[model samples]
Target: MTGSGHRALGLAAAALTVTGAVLVGTGVLPPATPPAPPQAVEASHPSRGRTPETGSRSAAPVLPRSEPRRLDVPRIGVHVPLSRLGLNADGTVQVPPVDRPEQAGWYARGYTPGERGAAVILGHVDGDGRRGVFHDLGRLRRGDTVSVTRADGSVATFVVQSVEQVPKSRFPSQRVYGPLDHAGLRLVTCGGGFDRQTGHYRDNVIVYARLA
Candidate 1:
């Protein structure tokens, strides 16, 4: 996908449960850097995390991690390993080639949930008939809960604030990519129903949630 394609794409962190890689070989993405492996922390229920609905780390954390170890959704009782990468210098998300799509995940060197700006998480909808980690991202609703386990053994929780379906032709880049100035989370994935022709959904579904 081109820069235009990326802007039209939705990469809601929560929506990652049903997302995938974009803009390969665009030279627009940044150089890939492996994570130094975040300190491991025990798992905790989203409720047991920092303050609810307004914790200090409630916003998205963009700290470097060994990798995105796990992704948890309280509302849907969904927990899965997160594998993927953020945009490079260009507007592309590095991911496995379509042949080995399931192997794709986040680069793990970008951000963590509940940091500064919006913590973005991405994934594939389906690969080889096997649903991707975020295959069911669209099921998320307002007031739902999403959790990410950081390497420093700290866990941040976020509460769903809103879900929007935007046409790929006009994605809310600044609103989504701009600095949050507060802890936040972005769950991105393809939606508005899948489009077989383009091999992607026509609209990007972004679920905006705040650190709770």
Candidate 2:
């Protein structure tokens, strides 16, 4: 979907549940305060965004034995605790308390970083003038390093491969939030541009990375 279309879809979804502090509004008002999420659900990685298999099957990502607890981005100088949340009925993830509007905590109860599948983390770009944790996420590029401090006190590195700003309308199901050949990381933020009437950012920025 086009960038503008994402705002429409996201706002439409937000409108339904009357989302709490995390209103998912335009850049004008203060960003909504995200809510707490449920525990993590353990599952294997799915091959939704992989190259089509010819006659042979492909291998999947091997998750680390230890789970991740903190995330660090040296390029951006970010060292923050991880938090998680489940998606609302509209498919948008519930927000978490981090710092700025663009930043959010991971749904900790769910998938851990370096797990067999994708570890999803989301934040807002700017809400009502407040900047969230992932506000600068759009700046990430392939090869950029994302380090995670695991619950076991071990650090794992990931290499970024893609940074896409997709419209909320055509959510990148397989592309943005899909599983990896091994443990991976998914970073989400609301960006592109802002709309006054719709009360939502123009596009959704997603950062994809694989364990290093």
Candidate 3:
């Protein structure tokens, strides 16, 4: 996707609607009052031409374009098939259906997983009185792994580099969807407190990872 496309998609995805209800298995509700999003800024560490998660100086290898079939986050027990998402009539990005909280959606207009650009995946935090596919997204730490199984029968493994929770008003559009030097992946979901007035979460949780 182009820079403009990235910005648009990021902003649209950031505005996801999340219902603040009891979490499945946890039996806990989100805070009524929204908490301030994290203010930490990520510093880039350049090592030759390699991706941030790797030590090699050589350019990272990229795969040919292929649709992603599934996503796996072993640490959080997330294993779900991916659905193709496109822009809506209003030009906003489409999201996974709230009724199916266990499914994830991939930005079909952007780079596919394993391609030399950021491939974005969006899931709900919670919905339909149950925890969503990415409900535990905030618990992921640096060095965690996320893998995408592609249509070509190859899996693209990515190593988590950073995670951020930012208000939808200040979503990092450029950083999350901008062109990259190597293959990258971004997992996004709603977080922060539930807003009864708006029926949406106040913040978004984004995970940045690079091909490994």
Candidate 4:
């Protein structure tokens, strides 16, 4: 999609401060990484005329709106409860409390986990010398599974499509927060070289996944 066609979701300049470092830096988004394999594309895109068996990672049926209760990334050993995150007074997205590094925050104003749009979840990579909920977010590879449990007791399972680490200055806001035809999930956290001067990571690690 053309960049201009997408909504300039306020997340473009969103940032959150952790204990002493910035977790999600301003204007951060996914990297300009190579496109995922064909199978992954099929899964991320709307099913349309294709049948389920056509793609091993075919998108799952969309679910009604509901608050996410938990997030699980079995491969990375992440099983944490989700907290509702909203915009800060200045319009940037809010982050989980610095003391609660084990919890991840879901963008409450965005699409729900099982909805036919990108649902964003944010966490810190590390804070106060402790590992954050998404410390291993960079380890997720294509075809991996990430699931979110909703308040309705249903789980929205997604197959990982790509993992990228990009500098905050080059954050692709359109691709990250833009509208999607199928259910998608985005897990984001700080990564790359840490700038001791600014107390923030130089890059953002973004994991893109599609419902399955």
Provide backbone clash counts, one per model. 50, 33, 0, 0
Model 2 lDDT at residue 140: 72
Query: What residue pairs clash in candidate 4, if any at all?
Result: none
Candidate with the larger TM-score of 1 and 3? 3
Cα RMSD, each candidate: 12.4, 10.5, 5.8, 8.1
- Candidate that would win on lDDT: 3
lDDT of each: 0.50, 0.56, 0.71, 0.68
Please provide TM-scores, in order, for all candidate models, with all chains considered together: 0.62, 0.67, 0.78, 0.76
lDDT for 145 (candidate 1):
86
lDDT of 4 by residue, 1-212 (tens): 22431222444323432211357333223232222223322233322422122244344578888889999999989998999887777656778876666779887878899887778898977655567788778778888999999999999999887776656675545556667677888887877766656656666677888888
lDDT of 3 at 112: 95
- Tell me the tens digit of each residue's lDDT in model 2 across 58-125: 55445555655678887765778765465556655567643345445664434567775566666666
Predicted candidate 3 versus true structure: per-residue lDDT over 1-212, tens digit per residue: 56765666565444332221211212234322222223423333221322334455277889988999999999899989999987777566777777777888898878899998888898877667677888888777788999999999999999898777766665666666667878989898777767666666667777889888
Tens-digit lDDT track for model 1 on 99-163?
44334354333345666655666554445444444445666766788887766776677788666
For candidate 1, what's the RMSD?
12.4
Q: Once model 4 is optimally superposed onto the true structure by TM-score, how far is the C-alpha of residue 149 displaced, in angstroms?
A: 0.5
Q: What TM-score does structure 1 among the candidates reach?
A: 0.62
